[model samples]
Target: MTSTHSRARRAGFAAFVGTTIEWYDFYVYATAAALVFGPLFFPSDDPLAETAAAFATFAVAFLVRPLGGIVFGHIGDKLGRRVSLVITLLLMGVATVLVGCLPTYADIGIAAPILLIALRALQGLAVGGEWGGAVLMSVEHAPEKSKTFYGGFTQLGNPAGALLASGVFAIMSRGGETFIIDGGWRIPFIASIVLIGVGLWVRYRVEESPVFASKVEGRKQSMPLAFALRANWLPILLGIGLLPISTGGYYLATTFATAYATGETVALSEQLILDAMTVASFVEFLVTLPIAWLGDRWGRKNIMYIGLVTSVLTFAPFLLVMPGRIEPAVFLLASLVRVAMSATYAPIAAILAQMFRPQARYTSIALAYGVGAAVWAGFSPWFATQLIAWTGSVWSVIAMFTGMAVLAGICTRLAPQHSDEAPVTASFTPRTDTRTNRLP
Candidate 1:
């Protein structure tokens, strides 16, 4: 027991570190898209058009994430979670570093944006495979009673990565807009190679998930993807339904908000918005584990209910406060929304992990999240920008945010939970299903 607990801790820490690095690479791209990618790669006469174009390239990664999930999910379910993760980290790191090295529009004209889109697609693929394996590494290794808490460790990476990305950009912006626009944005992308090295070292040292080792090792499926689709299709859809606040709403709050706050409408300084985001990420990081711990006692679904509702309530106020240009209010509201969202985000690792049995859990979870992220996170910033562009009001965005929150809440209620160790049952019921068998 003592050795198992120690191993679990090690695995959890490794999951946290690996995901933090991956998400840092991801968030740095998001931060750059909001800040410099527009003028640097996709020059435009209209500032909004430039931002929209940058966000379109940002969306490209997301569109390809589902394919990444399919490819890497196969490796994770067949080869090993550790093997898949190591490859993904290396792929993501190389792409991000190359992004930093690429020439801009001034240097290469149309090819610059094209190259940017290609790298972003690579990032999407890596990340599509990343979340499921990381979550399983932490949650599957966890003691049964503490799965949500250990899973929270994986959740910590999001805010930690966001904090690192936003904090670095915030510091870079202190050198003034010209400094960041001229060259500073590339530093974060290039610096990610160092984090990739550290993540690789940690991931290599950690043991493979015990669930995979004990239950899934010898009895490999002929085709994990086909098996998952045939058996876990409902859960996959439910998983996608449950992730709106975590995926789409999250980007709307952070990436889109950053650009919106600094846009012509709000007219706030870039530094101010970045600083607000930095503080909010820090606050979310502090609260995520505690909230995940609460999910154990309070019921993961109930905790998510609170988060989904709060997201609906707080998001409108967040937008309202931004236009006021009250610095303190902006910081407070942004942090508040993030805190609400954390409840929806943290327990998700365990929730999603438990949705499918260990047979093809990797592929199932990856597909769900990859598709959700592609649809939600990928287009959200651009969608929100277009919403404001068309309606000339933040209310349009608020309606979209509210809709996402509600959808998540409904799906949370509908999604079934399964224990990987539970005995296989012979049934295919949707809501009351508790089967954990490898399908024949």
Candidate 2:
């Protein structure tokens, strides 16, 4: 029992650190796109076009993320979670390190942005692969009574990573105007090398899943993806549906909020908005564990349902009132959005992992999550900005938020659960014979 407890601690810590590195590498690109890439790689006479071009490169990773999911899911499902996770860390680190070495447009003309896009694509692919393996490692290793709490470590990486990326740039910005505008952005991308090294070291220490260990003889699917598509497709769809609230909801709170606060309509200081996000990210990091604990005791789906409903109700008021005020109080109130996000985000690891049989859990969860990220997260921020541009109101974006919450709530209410209490079965269908595996 002590050994099992020790292993669970190691697994949770590994997931947290690995995901922190992966997300830090990914978010550094987002931060750089906003603050540096626009000026460097896509230097244009029109600032709008230049900004658009930089963001397009940022979006490229999301486009290829699903491909990464498919390829890496195959690796994790067939090869083992640890192997896929380590490879993903290496891939993301290498690409991020190369981005630091990349020549600017002035140095290499079109090849600069081309290479930038290629590196970003690699980052997307690596992260797409990384998430599933990390999530599985933690959830599968955890005690059944506390899977959500352990799983929260994976979700905890988001804000922790965002904070690191944002903090790195914030510090780098002080290195004088010439360094910042000319080349300092490379520092964060390059720093990924060190972060990945640390992640690899930590990830190496954790044991492989016993559940995965149990799959042998006739138990293992020869083609996990094929089996996932055939028998577990409903839960996969539900997973995708339930994810918009997380993937998109976060973008709404952070990226879109940044755009709205800094854009012409409100004209808040960029520094104010970024600082607010930094604070909110910290709050989210603090908030996730408690929500996950609650899920473990009460129910993962119930916590998620309440969170989605609260977010649906609060999102409009958040946009219309608090954020519009442009005060520090805005973040204090908006932190509740993070709390709402935690409801779904914290327990999602256990929830999604349990949705399908272990034979295809990695593939199904990874693919569905990749799709959700691409559509909801990758597009939602840009989409929110466009709605404001087209409709001249943030209310339209708020409506979109409400619509997503409704969809997620309905899906969560209906999703068939596969609980940690059940043994990993060869069959892809959820095991309803087990009382704990039944959806409430």
Candidate 3:
């Protein structure tokens, strides 16, 4: 028992650290896209067109995520989770550093945005593979009763990264928009190299997942992706359906909101939005573990339902109040919405992991999350921008947000749970018998 607890702690910490760095690298690009990428990379006469183009470059990463999942997921299912994760960290770090070094449109014209897209694509690929392995490393190592709690550690990386990214930008924006637009953004990207070194060292210190070693080490799947598609398609689809809030909704609240708040519609300062996001991220980070513990006690799906419902309710007010430029209201609403989001996001790692058997869990989860991100997260900001551009109202965005939350809630209720460990009472029960290892 002592040894198991110790191992779980080590794995959870390593997963948290690795994912935090990956997310930090990813969110920095998101921050830049909302703030500086338009003028710097994709220069345009119309501000809206420039913003749309910048978001398009941001979306490029999501396009390649499925491929990254396939490539690295295969490596994870066959070689080991630890091996794949280390490679992803290195890939993400190198790409981020290169982004910091790239010349802007003023310097290189079309080649500049083209190179930016390429680097962002690389980032998408790395993060595409990064999430599943990190979640599995923590959850698979945890004792059965504590799996959700440990899995929450993996989820922690999201807000922690967001907090770090937003906080860094908030500090830098103190130098003013002139400073940020000129060169302040590059510091975060270049500094990712140091984080990559730290992540590599921490990830190396953790052992391979005992689940993989015991069940899969000797007999590797020849084609994990094909196997996942054939046997795990239902769960994969359900997983995708269940992630609208965690994926698209999150970007809507942070990335799109930042741009909208700072754009002509709201005309708030960039620093204000960044500061609000930083506060929200910090609040979400603080509450994530407690919410995950609640999921363990009350039920994973129950907690998710609560989050989904509240997100819709809170989001409407946030949209309405944001346009008013009320500083205190903006700060309060941002944090409140993030707390609601954390309830939805924190328990999902374990829920998704348990939805598939060990044979191709890495590929299954990665593909589900990657494709979902591509459709929901990758395109959401751009879509919301276009919707506002066309309809001339933020309420269109509110309608879209509500629809996503509803979809995710339905999927969460229906998704099957399959695990090698003891069954979680609150999670969805599989209709098919566990003894036969078959899905309904």
Candidate 4:
């Protein structure tokens, strides 16, 4: 086998497993927020208010994500993607494990929730860097003809992590009411200890991106964040717009949907919701690769358009079924929504990397995705509940989802697509004079 192909394989595998671990840590918090965080940490007179407060803590991480992006983006751009990624993985793992060990409101009063939020903030910082670097590692190392397919490896983390989180929680939930409330949820959070070792081992094995290594010499920006904003602000804005359905909307389906179903709004069983989500997550894991493969043939934007239209149409139905008392069909809808979501999620790795010139690609992609996630995914559940509290109708939340979908579709149509230019490729040579040298 050729050296390039072998390196790409290692990079792709590292990206896949590393992101799975990072996202697994992230998803555990989301699931806990929706299910048990209120009683364990927030503890309020009004259940709805308690749920809202729990979500508020969940949103805290989003607030910190943009800052994390800038700090690590600079590191990735100036130092290397692999260096930035390893630090992120370690940081996230430590924070998540700490969260599993945190005391509840009953144990330490306000300090309990305070510590929880602090740890979550640290997680936000780690993830903000992890994603942009992971995607770049996979996409940049890929052969041009199969870039989308390889990019899908990084995207694979979302569903795989979600699957692991949901599945683990499903098992924990089986311990019954006494077990779940007592401390069952903590098990999933703590179990992540094992994953960290695996993530660290695999991430360290991967080589640096060939593209970044070749182009990284004198091309780095002194202020990559500032330069990215000045030069490629339009694509960055469009990139943020393009992400609502994939990031925030998916959270809506998983986080908010689970919360709403179990709460007084729909009053569905928690076990049922967790079970359905497990099935849906498994289905999503299965489908992401196929959809990404299709992106290679039909164009990433076109596949995203397909995902947008389907997700928009399904929003109301997906919500409608929540209150309708459907059985396994709820899982079916969840899987279908995720299938549509995969169209957007899987292809976006290649899309975002291609959108930016390699000059400040790390910073540009990180900043754009961080902001987009903060705006969209961060507040989706909180806002959905607020809308319900104000209007006394779930339709308001559905309307918001539809609105974001419409905006993303328009951005997908308006945004520019990237192409590989052979003329530019042969002219540039890899910088190898100093293997350990970095930009000043």
Candidate 5:
């Protein structure tokens, strides 16, 4: 390959790897909250309330994500994607390591949970910034010929991160509950420091987004959120409305599956849940890359329509089959549920990022997409688990998933096609960058 091609490819891969590490730090906490934190951190006599509290803490992180997205989104739009990328990785890595070192309720009374909340909030903030920065790094640097494919490549980090987190937790859990509760959990959280160093090194070598660089040169407004809101409220709102189904399905397959299988009287083995997650992550990553390629050719909305329809038809049956079973058949079914999620996820970054001008692209996409995705995806596992417990039927969760699919489908139908959307591609011009104020 030519030197230029090689450099871009390496840059894209580096961005992808950084995304994997950032997500690994994020998902490990979610996994622990699902299985172990209720017992270890909360230490309550009432099992139900304890589980609820744990999920509440898990959900609290997402509540902070919108703010994170707005904050980092402004920095990215003004300072450049590279700067935002470095800040987010360091923030996530430090928070994760701190979580590893936190004391449990048994050791510090109520202070333990309070400290845990603070750390998790930091994590939420870091992740809020991470997605927008990573997506922009890959897609902005990507060539015009393969925009969707390269964009999806960055998103592939989500599954890779999930695989690492699940694989590590699985290996650690084998040492038995006592081992996991006592110290095994710390191993995964502690691993983030090395990952962060590697991510920082990779990100530092990449140049600023071509789009942002040019926007600066053209005397564009520095305040991206204001520019986005004033110019593109319709698409922003639509993007927000469209994300619940994609994220809701993700939580159902990963977080809720573990809880429903383990938290109930008929709890399945932790090993089984981890194995299923590993396989699902593998399949989703493999499938997402190719589907994103198709999205570039066939149109993102068209592919999304197919996915949403499939989800609407399959949601009820999938959830119905998930509980009271733990075999190869159920495993295959679970993996397919994840595949459906991957279909929507693969093209979403590019599609959403396409909605605004280059100057405001970062903030518009991050706040609208990031905030919506976190609220829908982050809280989903907890919501599904609670719904299952309250209704005593997996069908209720399935119904919820199906409803979200329909909602996303409607929004997808309304979205402007890529050719119709304004361009966000980077330019060669140079100018001063402006930092925007944070969104409310």
Candidate 6:
């Protein structure tokens, strides 16, 4: 390979590893909150209410992600990508480990739920900052021709983290619910410490993205959030619309499925759900890289639009296939389709990363992405479950996913085809750091 290609590959691999570690910390909670958090931390007389509360708690983390992204994006744009990554990794790892140590409702009463919310919020922030840093690192370092592929490589981290998170949960479940609630869940949370260390070691070794480096050397945005809002309001709105489709789909597919299965006894065994998720993640991992590669030849928007269409078409069948009883065949098919949507968007990091000049890309993309995710994706699982409870069918939830995906496509299409090539006249620089580094 050419030297530039090699550098991009190395950077992509490192970003991939960092993303995996970052997401691993984030997703472990999803598994726990769905399976054990309600019983352990939010114990209540009504099982149904308890589950709803647990889902709400899960959504809380997402609510805080926008602020986290704004803060981290500022740091990445102004300070450096390397520093932003380091702090984000440390924040996520520390918060996750703390969750492992938190006292349950049995021991701490109301404080248990309070602590859970705090930790979840912390996690949201950590992750909110993470995506921008990791994606920028990979996309900036990538060879111009293969940038999307590198972005896809970094995106692989999602499935990698998801697989590991699900695998851990599945293993713990095999030991029995008592074992999981008592101590098993802690294993995954505590594991974050080790991942943090690995992520830091590699992250510190890399240089900042050349694009970001050049921007910093020139003059960084003083207020990235404000600049982004003023200049790219339309992109931000479109991005937000799309966020619910993917974010909603992800949470609903993983957490909601677990809840539905466990409650109805039709959901696959914990082991089975874990296995299905693993398979889906593995498929996602395999497909994401190629999708990103394809974007390079075709266009990032081309691939994403296709994925959006797929999401719209597959929504109903995906849910309909999941019945009260776990049908391994149906489960696999549904999970694979979900994986396809994820895979299609795998290269989107590079697409979004290129949307603005390096001077403002961090803030513009970060704020837009964060707002989209927080408003749409953040509460998706909670909304879906609540809707399901209300309507007694999954049609509404499926429609929501399909609708958002279509909207995202339209919005994404509205963005300039070559954002990196776009001329700019204005920018913003943050006057002060807004990040609250408190970990749960």
Q: What's the lDDT of the predicted structure labeled candidate 2? A: 0.80
List residue ranges in candidate 3 displaced over 4 A: 422-440
| Model 2 per-residue lDDT tens digits across residues 337-429 | 777787878888888887777777788889888887888887786677667778988889988998999898888877776654455444534
The superposed Cα distance between candidate 6 and the true structure at residue 157, in angstroms, equals 0.7
Of candidate 1, the 10-residue stretch with the lowest lDDT total is 431-440
List model 6 lDDT by residue over 1-440, tens digit each: 58767778778888999999977887898888778887787778877677888888888877888888889988887788889888988898889999999989989799989988998899889888888888888988876667788888778898889878988887787897578877888999988888888888988888767766654556766887776777777656655664555566666667776776666535556666677777777777778888888877776667777777776666566567666354666567656676667744685787677655566567667776777777776777778778877888778888777777767766666654343322333453222111110011
| Alpha-carbon deviation at 116 in model 4, angstroms | 1.0
Across 369-419, the per-residue lDDT of candidate 4 in tens digits comes to: 899999999999999989999999888999899899999888777665454
Candidate models: Cα lDDT each: 0.90, 0.80, 0.90, 0.85, 0.75, 0.74
lDDT of 3 by residue, 75-99 (tens): 9999999999999999999999999
Name the lDDT value of residue 346 in candidate 1. Answer: 92
As a whole number from 0 to 100, the lDDT of residue 372 in candidate 1 is 93
Give candidate 1's TM-score.
Answer: 0.96
As a whole number from 0 to 100, the lDDT of residue 194 in candidate 4 is: 95
Cα error of candidate 4 at position 409, Å: 0.9
Residue 241's lDDT within candidate 5 is 77
Which is better, 4 or 5, measured by lDDT? 4
Better of 2 and 6 by lDDT: 2
Ranking by TM-score: 1, 3, 4, 2, 6, 5
RMSD of each predicted structure:
3.3, 2.4, 3.6, 5.4, 5.4, 6.1
Model 2 root mean square deviation, Cα atoms: 2.4
Between candidates 2 and 4, the TM-score winner: 4
- Model 5, 38-151: lDDT tens digits are 888888887766777888788777888878888998898778888888998899999999999988888988998999999999988888888877787777666654567777
Question: Which pairs of residues collide in model 4?
Answer: none
lDDT of 5 at 125: 88
lDDT of 4: 0.85
Best by lDDT: 1
